[model samples]
Target: MDEYPFTKLVIERNLTREEFAILMERLEKLNEQYEAQKEEGLIHFSSLLIHFAGMLTEKLEPDSTINALQREGFYPSLMNEFIRIIKQNNKG
Candidate 1:
């Protein structure tokens, strides 16, 4: 496969190339929707990314990979920002 960081990361986590491709295709669609309606679609894009990450890590022991991600300060960081953005938008 290509040498993109996200692709490599997902592959390292046990997602096959085919599964990664499928997820990429779905993410592309979500990106398009988010672009067309930026404010309204940010949550969808962020949520999809988080869900894809969870799916990619499914082969690992339950919550093991996710906990590592949190410890390493990756997904949890983004999740916090996404939640804050969602809450702020909801308030306005």
Candidate 2:
């Protein structure tokens, strides 16, 4: 399976395992803040997600990046759920 995106960043930065753990801790706190503010909406969050997708497209071959994203699962699963919902609704 392709490495997780954050794992690639950790390897590139040569972060120690301890340092990566600390970074994960910080990410968790940031996630909490994101959840808290979600109802209020966040432009930067959407921008960051779009910017990351664009960066990946620029940095990797199309197939390689897609494999990595599929391993990550969130986007693929989200699309699958959306399709399922649409199909179910159309059956009514």
Candidate 3:
């Protein structure tokens, strides 16, 4: 978007053609990344960039944020539950 100068600045850098193309593509697609940023890899990365844009837009509508947080692709909570069960078994 002409509204943001990140694309302009990156293009002005010494990046190779492939890098520049990838950068432009990413900036162009950032809005589409909002759904999966918290998970990992491509989706999470895109989601993260979109999330950063939220600051410029001035709000993070809790529904989306909480949904991203709740996706169980990775899990500390699950491991915690397993540990709790192991401790209970040890105690028993």
Candidate 4:
């Protein structure tokens, strides 16, 4: 496997339905997380890295992934999206 392909697949494999759901639930939050990291003075590259982090997160341990986000200071960003996604999901 090539590096990029291998990595993407490896990460995708770890994603749980809930995690994906959570991500979908909170894309705005994800975007916000992106902004916060930037505003917090995490460089642009590091800010962009949040997406990679999200992918890695989806592929790795779910709770741990969220914990890591919290540790890195992404929770607030994720809040809006979480609420949106949750409400959307509930309509069934």
How many clashes in each structure? 0, 0, 1, 4
Candidate 2 per-residue lDDT over residues 1-92, each given as its tens digit: 14585356446557677765664464345445545555577423533333333533233433343344445553564223334444565698
Candidate 4 lDDT (Cα, 0 to 1): 0.50
lDDT of 1: 0.50
The best candidate by TM-score is 1
For candidate 3, give the lDDT: 0.38
Cα-based RMSD of candidate 4? 12.6
Give the range of the ten consecutive residues with the poorest summed lDDT in model 3. Answer: 56-65
Q: For model 4, how does the per-residue alpha-carbon lDDT over 40-69 read when each residue is reduced to its tens digit?
A: 876434333345455544256443444444
Better of 1 and 3 by TM-score: 1
Error of 3 at 36 (Å): 9.4
The residue-by-residue lDDT of candidate 1 on 1-92, one tens digit each, is: 33344444565677776765775575456445545655564444555445545654345432343344334454454434445545666799
Residue clash pairs of candidate 1: none
Per-prediction TM-score: 0.41, 0.41, 0.27, 0.28
- Measured by TM-score, how close is model 4 to the native structure? 0.28
RMSD of each: 8.0, 9.0, 15.9, 12.6
Write out the backbone clash pairs for model 2.
none
lDDT of 2 at 60: 42
Give the worst 10-residue stretch by lDDT in candidate 2: 57-66
In Å, residue 75's CA in model 2 sits off its true spot by: 11
